[model samples]
Target chain A: MRKLKAVKITQAIVELVKRANFSLRKDVLFALRKAYGFEKNRRAKTILKAILDNAAYAQKENLAICQDTGMPVVFVQLGQDLKISGNLKAAINSGIESGYKKYSLRNSICKDPLLRGKSGFSPCIIHMDIVSGNKITLTLLPKGFGCENKSQLKMFKPTSSLEEIKSFIIDAVKSAGADACPPYVIGVGIGGSADYASLLAKKALLKKIKLQRGLSPKGTVPGLERELLFEINNLNIGPLGLGGRATALAVNIQTYPTHIAGLPVAVNISCHALRSAEIVL
Target chain B: MKRIYTPLDLNKIKSLKAGQEVFLSGTIYTARDQAHKRLVQAIKSRQTLPFELRDAVIYYCGPTQTPQGKVIGSCGPTTSSRMDAFSGFILAQGLRGMIGKGSRGLGVKEAIKKYKGIYFITYAGCGALLSKYVKSVKKVAYGDLGPEAILKLEVENFPLIVAIDVNGGSVYG
Candidate 1:
């Protein structure tokens, strides 16, 4: 029997939540820089420059990059062999509460979808999975509502081909317009049930734009993400959709073997302020 | 591109156009979905608001709490469309400028044209960076909405993009 290793995910969770609210990830900054380099529209390029500069200033100042720090969301893939030293729920909640309170991060959560505390960062949503491994991997995401409001998922006919999936993602981004904030990361979950697929799609948001190039499995941009990038950017929404290139920095696709006759696809939209952090314990 | 802090009185607001950047100095009010609803209700009943709306600019913001000795935390613009329903009503009460991100639906566009009001948008999610421009905070209202409540803010050299102009020029272009 592979005995469990006593690991505490709380400390890491606390850091992850606060740090995520504090600033954006390094790879996210790199993606923004790259977009700034390649942006075509003169106005869009200028806008991208200011945004890139702001990201750096936000970090050095130890301030949140965006005002809406977003709600605390986590996806935990616990290794079966990993054991908990402390109370997991307390650890998670404490970390989140402290992060928001200490950092002065906005608490955008509410008990009722329509009403909640003035603290923008109330109510947290967490999902856990026990995978086959010795080390636990926890991905924390502080998802902003601007993009969350634009996310969509639906079940398509099993006969839908790759072209159909690509079209759906393009249309989704186009429809969202400038609301979700352009130069975003588009995560598409395909091949899961309607419900499971939405969660899976969000899980895929963990993949940063620069990191998508060399994923462990097959490596390099897959058929899905490559087409998604070309198609969505072609919409000419550009940075902030002010009419120039650099609409989406990247599109990431995650799939699972699903039952026959059911093809579900969900698109999780992430704004340019991709404020998220993670920890491994 | 221009960053300056000046009083947001009627004369200053009257000369401003839509899509023109103005770094508001002096005291400006903040409100969003909840407060807008209340403001509209008060107007409907011929009741005065907590503050006057004539020639005033109401930022559609719900800011985070400030740490000790600070005026505010990361504060940024929100989806302006959500507050569109109350804009026309508020504009009628002499409201001049509304600031938020994202495109306003047709209703808001028409309202802006009719009322000679302009819409401005600051950089979204750059709340922390933007807060530095805030010189001081006078008061907070509707605390129940958390970040969504109202703030009486005084900013210096704040940056924003003129999203919509008094002449009907829109930033959505």
Candidate 2:
């Protein structure tokens, strides 16, 4: 079995956190530029330009794209044949603590949900998967509360029509208004159990931003992604919900097979920043 | 773009219309949910506010830490809707303007009309660019809240759009 040092993992996590916060991915930048071109409202155009400029400033000055560095959501794909030498969770949390402190990132985590107190940015949330390989892959998605708070999951009977599903997404996005930050990305997960469906939706957000908009991965309903994108943009929420043509940049969907009795759907939204980074070890 | 100075008076805010682009300059206070709660509590308990509320522009932001040898960190508008409930209370205290991102609730709109207030929306997710406008920042109150502490910020040419006018007109509509 291949042996991987936990310190190396911790180092990777630390670097990933910095990269994710400071840099806007190329695909995401391209999408923002594309939205700027397609957006008709002059106000929306100005806001998009500011967003693009902000991204450039972040990259140049080594500053976080947004003050809300966000909670570290780490996705780890561990090799089945590899042995981790140190405590995995401990290493992950240690990296987050050190990186956040060293970079002066905001500490947004609370001690508990109801009774809010400082958690010192410890206990990083991590999702792990075992795959057939010798290399471990880690993707860090720093999810801000603005977009995360607006995500929703709904379980409908299998008999629900496609139109019903479509409206559900539309209403959710419309109601979210500028709160979730418009001209954002939408990740949809369909057909899994409640929790699994939401997880899939969140995972879908980490996928590459394609040149083509609303392109779902395999096994999803064909063309549904594109159709939803059109409907959502037509809502006229625009950039920052100030009213315009570019409410959503893209809508990506991932689906899984589920029991016949029920269909679970989850919608995860991401702000225009869409900060994410990955590393392979 | 039109330019507006801080410590905005009711007359000046009332002249602004929804969707008008404006560059704001002068002093502003920074506060998010936690500081807002305390502000309201102070008012209800008949205690002095952390800052003078009359004609003040409150920014809905929680900036990252000021790095070594820096005046401030990346600072951007947070979601405005989260503070919708407390907006009316603050407005009633004689606030002239607010800067944030996103839409406001109907209650906030009504209060804006009743109190003749302005809701300014800045570029969302553009903290780095926005920080360029902030000349200086000093913690004024609630340091225990960390990033959510109330701050006195001196800004120059801070870009914003009037999302809600004193007449209750909203850009989101």
Q: Please give the C-alpha DockQ score of model 1.
A: 0.66
**How would you encode candidate 2's per-residue C-alpha lDDT over B29-52 as one tens digit per residue?**
999998999999999999988899
> Lowest summed lDDT over 10 consecutive residues: which window, candidate 2 chain A?
A213-222
Query: How many angstroms is residue B101 displaced in model 1 relative to the true structure, after the best TM-score fit?
Result: 0.6
- Which residue pairs in model 2 clash with each other? none
Q: Please give the TM-score that candidate 2 achieves against the real structure.
A: 0.96
By DockQ, the best candidate is 2
TM-score of each: 0.91, 0.96
What TM-score does each prediction get for chain A alone? 0.89, 0.96
Q: Which stretches of candidate 1 lie over 4 Å from their true place?
A: A1-7, A114-120, A211-221, B1-22
DockQ of each: 0.66, 0.80
Candidate 1 — number of clashing residue pairs?
12
